[model samples]
Target: MGSAVRIARETTEQVLAEWGVGPQEPCTGPVLLILSELVANSVRHAAVLSPKVTVIFAGGPDAFAFGVHDRHPYRPALYSPAVAGSGRGLATVMELTLELGGSAVVRGDADEGGKSIWVTLPLRRSGAPGAR
Candidate 1:
């Protein structure tokens, strides 16, 4: 799981750089953190049913998006109250995403039994108001 997170972070960093999202960008840290949390959740709860996890990244001039996917059929409730340690992962993802003027959604894979949780954030210029 640690390796999974590290690999995902590194790959995401590369992708973001390719898209011209600098390390100092306001949304960069939250994007990496959200990806980490999502990967961790998949390892912790979905590994039994899904041996492989996929991370998807997409970006445009105005928005950046990513998704974590697994073969587990369970779709978590993103806004549900945290059940001790069980529910905080998606909650944190949701919180940071919404705070950055972003939205998240869960999509089921039609050819498979799993799901993908996708998050999209508006891209603000470095010095813009609320950029940080």
Candidate 2:
């Protein structure tokens, strides 16, 4: 699980760097942290039902998005009482994303089962209004 988190972070960093988003960029830190929390949630909650998890990342000039997917059939709400013991990871993910002017959604695979939680955030310049 730790290795999974590490790999997710490293891969996301590399991809962002390749996209010309530097480590010190305003969106980079929150993006990485959100990815980490999503990946960790999948590992801790869905790993038993889904042995493998996938991380998907996409970005462009305006905004960047990523999703964490698992084969488990359960699709968790962004803020639900059912997710009590899972810690505050998802809550933190939501808070940080919204603070950065972003959005999140959970999509379930109708045919195959499982779900993917995706988050998208605008790429704001350091001095831009609302940049964090």
Error of 2 at 113 (Å): 1.1
TM-score of each: 0.90, 0.90
lDDT of each: 0.87, 0.87
What pairs collide in candidate 1?
Answer: none
Candidate 2: C-alpha lDDT: 0.87
After superposition, the stretches of candidate 1 with alpha carbons farther than 4 Å from their true spots are: 82-85, 128-130
Once fitted onto the true fold, the runs of candidate 2 whose alpha carbons sit more than 4 angstroms away are 80-86, 127-132
Clashing pairs in 2: none
CA RMSD per model (angstroms): 1.9, 1.9
